[model samples]
Target: MKYLVTGTAGFIGFHVALYLLNRGESVVGVDNINDYYDVNLKYQRLAECGIDRGNVSDNKKAVSSKYPEYSFYKMDLADKAVLMDIFEKEKIDVVINLAAQAGVRYSLTNPDAYITANIQSFLNILEACRAYPVKHLVYASSSSVYGANTKMPFSTSDNIDHPVSLYAATKKSNELMAHTYSHLFNIPTTGLRFFTVYGPWGRPDMALFLFIQAIEKGQPIQVFNHGKMKRDFTYIDDIVEGIIRVADRPAKPNPEWTGQDPDPGSSYAPFKVYNIGNSQPVELMDYIGALEKAMGKEAIKNMLPLQPGDVPSTYADVTDLKRDTGYQPQTSVEDGVAKFVAWYKKSYGK
Candidate 1:
């Protein structure tokens, strides 16, 4: 099967592309390679896919030496014409749209970025899917969509109407947009609500990365909510597995779905939402402890109140995902943190 994976240079996207490529599947990957974090890390991910960063051009294709079946392009999903053209040319069977303007705190500072990348770009993707009619379209959603809901172990069935941040709102918007497409065009769409995903080649802005960096540099690591937060920190590999499984299976109309009492997770239309998480929530302090162990260093702590647009806790109830795709996040915080620190050391030449 030929798959088109957006944000191939991203943490999750890179892992997903690698997984598919390792399975001997043909993949057409795309990424804008924005400077949201470090473009060098993005380039390094491309390098791992055997894409020569020196040869990269706008919308230009590059082949992978390690996985000859894999090819990549430097493109933004916001470019409707280019995205549509790629869809038409690639004859893409499945699309895993991971590209987006990520970061909740950043959204507060730069709302336009969220509007352009998350909202506008997603509309383009939806339109492309509607026009081209792919078998399955799996896009990245977030646990943040749960927003102000204080419910423990958030279920997909729960209403995600109250979003705390623009980023969360945009993700929720993607789900709604996808549902509309599924309803109107009969396009199968699956949205995966990812939790705090962390592993090798993770994003620098994320908690794990920041904590590691601060600890290594002997700088103070900010502990939000005074280390009173709990998160369903999932491994990247597990998230990728769930994504691939869902992508392989096109969403089907829920047979039991009724207009009288609609299920938010499933619909009469070919649309579904699943929470891809560890099902285990870890405390912020415990996570920090794990990080300290991994790095063998003590962190200079700066405990602070929860930032605006930030949640105190996030726990995903992935029962539906397990039922549908046999998805389970196996990596514990201890194991996961050790692996990340190991990768960080090697990647940074420490």
Candidate 2:
């Protein structure tokens, strides 16, 4: 079966595409290649996937030299016409929509980006799926949607009506939009609420990447919430595994679902949401300690108050995901940090 994996230039998207290709699955990847962080890193990721930077342009297909079954297109999902062309041409069986305007802090200053990249793009994707039906549509949501809920181990069933940041709000909107599509169009949609994912080839904007880069350079690392912040620091491999597993299982209506008492996670329609996290929250300081141990360098620290649109902690309850997909996140902070550091050193020659 052919899969269309959006956000191929991003960390998770790149990893997912490569994993599918390695397994001999036909995969088509698309990304706007936006310069949210560093376009070079994005290009490098594409190059690693055997799509030459020079060969990529808008709405053009660049087949991978490394993997025969893999192809990539540099395109924005907001462009419905071009996106529809892809859906019509490729006969995409499944779609893993990972593209979005990522970053809680960035969303604060640039709310329009969130609207364009996250909301508009997602709507176009849904429209394309509606026009050309797919067996499954798995997309990325975030634990950030558990905003202001002091509840430990955030569950899928919890009410996510409040989102602290525009980024989180957009993710919540995606879930709502997906549910509507599932209801109206009979689409099978599954949303995965990813926690703090980190590992090799991770996004430079992420805490893990920033902390490690600063420590390696002997610079001060910003400790948000004055080191009180905690995250379910899930490994990239674990996340990719969960995505594949969930994608393989098309969502089915919850037989026990009732409108009298609605479930936010599942519905009578073919729609489901699951949290894919490590289920272990690690303190910010402890995560830094792991980075230090891996890099053999101490980081100068800068204690900072909790920034706006930031949560003090995030813990995921993966019971539903485990029950449904047999998904188990296996990497601890230490091992994941070590793997990232090793990759950073090799990639950057640090």
Query: How many clashes in each candidate?
Result: 0, 0
Candidate 1, run of 10 with poorest lDDT? 59-68
The whole-model lDDT of each prediction reads 0.92, 0.94
Give each model a TM-score: 0.99, 0.99
* Predicted candidate 2 versus true structure: per-residue lDDT over 1-350, tens digit per residue: 99999999999999999999888899999999998989999999999989999889888999988888888899999999999999999999999999999999999899999999999999999999999999999999999999988888899989988889999999999999999999999999999999999999899998888888787678899998899999999999999999999999999999999999999999999999999999999999999999899988899999999999999999999998899889988888899999999999999998
**Model 2: lDDT of residue 297:** 85
Clashing pairs in 2: none
lDDT of 1 by residue, 132-216 (tens): 8899999999999999999787999898899999999999999999999999999999999999999999999999888888888
> For model 2, what is the alpha-carbon lDDT of residue 64?
88
Displacement of the residue 314 alpha carbon in candidate 1, Å: 0.6
Q: List where candidate 1 sits over 4 angstroms from the true fold.
A: none
